[model samples]
Target: MPAPRPPTVPVLEVYSTFQGEGLRVGERQVFVRLARCDLRCAFCDTPESYPTPDNARVQRQPFGAKDEALPNPVALDVLLAAVERLDDPPGLHAAVSITGGEPLLHPHAVHALAVGARRLGLRVHVETGGHRPGAVAHVLEVVDEFSPDLKLASATGAPTPWDAHRETYHLLEGRRKALCVKAVVGAATPEAEVEAAAAFAVEHLPSAPLVLQPATPYGDGPAAPSASTLFRLHRAAGRAHPDVRVIPQVHRFLGLR
Candidate 1:
């Protein structure tokens, strides 16, 4: 039998952009967008990542100064090399942001990458869906920051794993890891829903910052939440958790990828 094609390493879309949200807003950062996702949010901007059985249709996009997909069946050494290439000389940006369809999907790879980054004295941050507590713990062990999006009515047809997400949030509690819980506020984000998410975070991760973002105007029928609705949602979230803050996608504002 022909040698089976090597399993594609989880590729990262490495690019430079101002942080669109969270505690490090406006900071210059290298965004590493990992491929693949477990859930299909209706308003998923990167619908291409929705895990489908057919793999041939996966398209590769240009990344930063390099035009290569990440190491398929990636090894720690090869993945580290990609990180090194992202920086000129070394350490040009603020930190490495590990975002993806859901970085947790590839726990082993992410753990390897984070361990390597720490050895190089590079700061690491991870953005996730809060699905896998163990995966989140592994990434959090090496990362400086944890930005987990507590999915609040993601237009994607899949149901949110509230218990799992909540467990991850609590698991990170008491750790020095800076945690930020982000909720995508959309038309579906009712005041009660916002309060529930906020309350859960407040109860579990009281010290972690909570961020509320308006849904993007993308996807088949995406619509931006109104300013009035945002105000109410923001108020409700804040009432539940004093640390809540409203932030929009700043990268979109600056017109960077």
Candidate 2:
């Protein structure tokens, strides 16, 4: 019998984009946007990532090159090659960010991709909705950084997954590289909830900084919080976490993807 074929992933797209949020804002990186999500956050900006696309659009070369449409369920090795292809003009990218509708949904593929990216001499970063401890545990060793969100009810339009978030944070304690805990604060976000999230972050993952990202107005989604609201949430967060900063979507400010 023939050997089993390598695993494939249902991908959305692969391209070069700047790290537009959290601690790594403004840093250029290759992005691997995987498809499908477990949660339907009301304020999610990339709702497009929520569905499994028919093809994964990949940029063949850097600097506004036309994207190549590869069939969905792209081969793991092919995905890695696409990532390597974007590294033209050597040393241009600082890292590779694995983002998604919820990247941890594909933990096995994530682990493999992280290993492949690391082998290419690039730092590997993964962003998640902050509620998948089981999946987080599977890819922890291969990943260098974690950007897990502390989902707020006011923002996500769903009950906060406190237990899962706590467990996930605990799993990331003493992490190999860095972790940035993010909470999206909307106009309706409560000070009490923000405080709770801050306390949770400091208590479980004290090493990681907490970032308060003001929700950007999206179609039927949460509206952007006012300057005063942002300041109030920052103060509330700082009560527990020493490092708390209010950052908006920088890529939107710079008109980047």
Candidate 3:
């Protein structure tokens, strides 16, 4: 019998762009945006990434050029080629950001991608919603960094469970240098939620930075949080975590996708 091929993942798009949020804000990196998400936050910017159509396709956009649609559930080799095509000198990017509607939803494929990227002399940054701690754990050994979102019910307009996020934070405790907990604060985001998220970070990942991203207005979602509201929320987060910082979506400000 032949060895079974590694299961492929549903990739939505692959491109090279500057990191827009969390600790890596402004850093140039290659983004491997995987498809599908379990949560539906009201402030979601890429709602299009949440659904997996019957004939889903992955868009390959090298160096921000025109996108070329490819078949979905792309193999590791194809994904690496997509990343390589985006690289000007190859292996020049600071990290390969494996982001998603929720990347952890496909842990095995994520692990394979991270391992492959590491072999290519690139750091792997797994950007996840932190809703699936088990999945996160499965790839923790292979991934170099984590950018976990701590969702809030007020912003998501849905129940944001705390257990999984708490567990994932616990797992990232010793990796303070590679861990950044991000919470999206919308115009209607409650100050209490911000404080709670900060407190949770302080309790589990005290050394890690906590980023409060003022939700960027997208789709028919609520407007971005006002400057005053952002300031207030920053103050609230600061009370619990010393490294709390308010950074909005830098790519949105810079007119980059």
Candidate 4:
């Protein structure tokens, strides 16, 4: 009998870029953006993730519209191949950043990829929305870094599961891995939320960095969050969590992958 095959995992897109956020910001990394999201935040940066074949709750939107569905799913093998083909391959000491659509939603698959990457000596990092701690824990063994977002005032009015996020951060606190808490900034990200998120980070992951990203202008909309808002948030949040820093979506600024 043939050996049982590993389950195939669906990936949205893969590209190479300077890690635009989190503790490992500006590092050359292979970004694997997976293809689904549970939450529908009004200001969701990658609205393209909402309507996978799995997102039955999703309503299809136009290509450049608010919530566009991805037609192709890159399997795990194909994804790995693409990473190896990057321009600065091998010499870059690739850091595999498994982001979302909510990477924790596919923890088993993400963990598998991380394990495989580590075998090749690549560091692994994960960026999640902090919805499921149980799922997050399963990948901790292979994940070298954790960058969980503490969602604040989601555009859809969904509440942040602070308890779950806090629990997961604590799990990574003293571990050998580096950890960071990120909050995506928007016009609606209240000052109170910034203070609270910063305070929570300081109380929980005291040594970990906190990242603030100003929402970028994507799709037909009024505008992205202003620079003033980003500065204000960085200052206030930094007051509580001294390591807090502002990082915009560099891909947008540079107009590249």
Candidate 5:
């Protein structure tokens, strides 16, 4: 029989950009943004990812010199190929960032994509909403780094899923692999919420670094929190977590997509 076809998932786009978030910020990475987010964060810049797309936009040449559209439910092979294309002179790129719509939702696809990335001598990073513990456990071994968002009601427009967050952290803690927690705070985000998120990180994954991402203005998303709010939130959260740092969406600053 011919070799089995690769698993497929709804891919939004595949492109290369500098790591724009916590921990590995500034590293060159090919981001595979999948479609279908579960949360409605008021400040989500990529609101387009909340729904499935008709096709996945792929960078067929370095620096996006050429682009192609692969029909939705794209195969794992195509994703790897896009990464390879963007890599240019080879090894110029770093890890393959497997991002939203909540990547953990498609655990099997995440594993397949991560494995393919490893074959190409690249690391695997999965960005999640930090609510799906079962899915996290399933793909934890394949993923090299976990960048999970701690969804706060004050920012994401949904009540905090404390139980799910705790359980997910319980699984990720103490692993040799990297872990970074992120909480998006808006201008009106209460200080108490930030403290709670920081304390939760300290209590569960004390070794994991936490990032306070100020919400950037997009549609219903609040504008960047005032400097006063940012300072107070960081100050309060920093008291509980040793590695807490405030990092806005750096890609925005660079005018990158």
Candidate 6:
């Protein structure tokens, strides 16, 4: 019998841009934005990426050029070509970020992409919602960095999967320096939720940085957390984790996507 074909993933966009969040914030990287997400955060900026449209086209924006449209359900070779195209100067990118609506939804594709990025002498960074430890485990060996979000029910208006989040954190236990948990805090986010996320980080991945990102305004999302509220959350998180940092979405401030 012939070998089974690798999965073809629905890609939304691939571009060369600055890292927008977490520990690698402001660093230049190639972003592979995949399509589809299970959780629906109220403040989701890329709602367009959440659903796979029938006419969905992958936007390929290589460095120093306008974006070109490619067909969706792209093959791995095609995706790799897009990444290579964006990395024009060849090792200029700090990393190739595999982000998404939820990249882990296509674990095999993500793992393959990570492997390909490593071949090009680029670090592979996986950004995820951290709700699927199994999917994350599939790519752990190939990925150099993991940035998982600790979703809060109050902030996201979705069910919080504490167990899965914990499992994900524990998976990154030994990779502290290369891992970080980003918790989005809104003006209405509960203190308890922030504390729980911080406590988990302290217990499972103490050395890993815990970033409390003030939610950026999107759609009808709540207002950004006030200075006092952000400070309070920072202090609360700091109590549990010594390396807690309060950072907002820098890309939004700079008017970049």
Name the candidate that leads on lDDT: 2
- Report the error of model 4 at residue 160, Å: 1.4
> Which of candidates 1 and 6 reaches a greater lDDT?
6
Sequence-dependent TM-score of model 4 = 0.82
lDDT of 1 by residue, 23-75 (tens): 78887666666778877776677766554222221112224332554434454
RMSD of each: 4.0, 1.2, 2.1, 6.1, 1.7, 2.2
lDDT of 2 by residue, 1-257 (tens): 99998799989999998889999998989999999999999988888888888899999976666899999899999999999989877568989999998999999999999999999888999999989999999999999999999999989999999999888888888673446889998999989999988998899888888899998888999989999899888998888889998888899998877
Q: Give the Cα lDDT of each candidate.
A: 0.72, 0.90, 0.81, 0.70, 0.85, 0.83
Off by over 4 Å in 1: 1-8, 51-66, 69-71, 154-158
Per-prediction TM-score, please? 0.85, 0.97, 0.92, 0.82, 0.95, 0.92
lDDT of 4 by residue, 1-257 (tens): 99876466656666566777665767877777777888776557677766554421111211232433334544566556555655343747468788878888888889878987776678888888876789877888889887877777733357877898788877778684546777777776777788888998889778778878776655542245677777777878977888887877776666565
Q: Show the colliding residue pairs in model 5.
A: 43-221
Superposition error at 76 for model 6 (Å): 0.6
Please identify which of the two predictions, 2 or 5, would achieve the higher TM-score against the true structure. Answer: 2
Candidate 3's residue-wise lDDT over 4-44, tens digit each? 97578888778778899887788879888889999888889
Query: In candidate 4, where is summed lDDT lowest over 10 consecutive residues?
Result: 55-64
Task: Give candidate 3's TM-score.
Answer: 0.92
Clashes of each: 6, 0, 0, 0, 1, 0
- Tell me the lDDT of candidate 2: 0.90
Q: What's the distance in Å from true for residue 216, model 6?
A: 0.7
Task: Please identify which of the two predictions, 1 or 4, would achieve the higher TM-score against the true structure.
Answer: 1
lDDT tens digits, residues 9-109, model 5? 99889988899988888989989999988887787878788888898888776452667899998988878877887777788888999998788778889
TM-score of 1: 0.85
- Looking at model 3, residue 98 earns an lDDT score of 93
Better of 4 and 5 by TM-score: 5
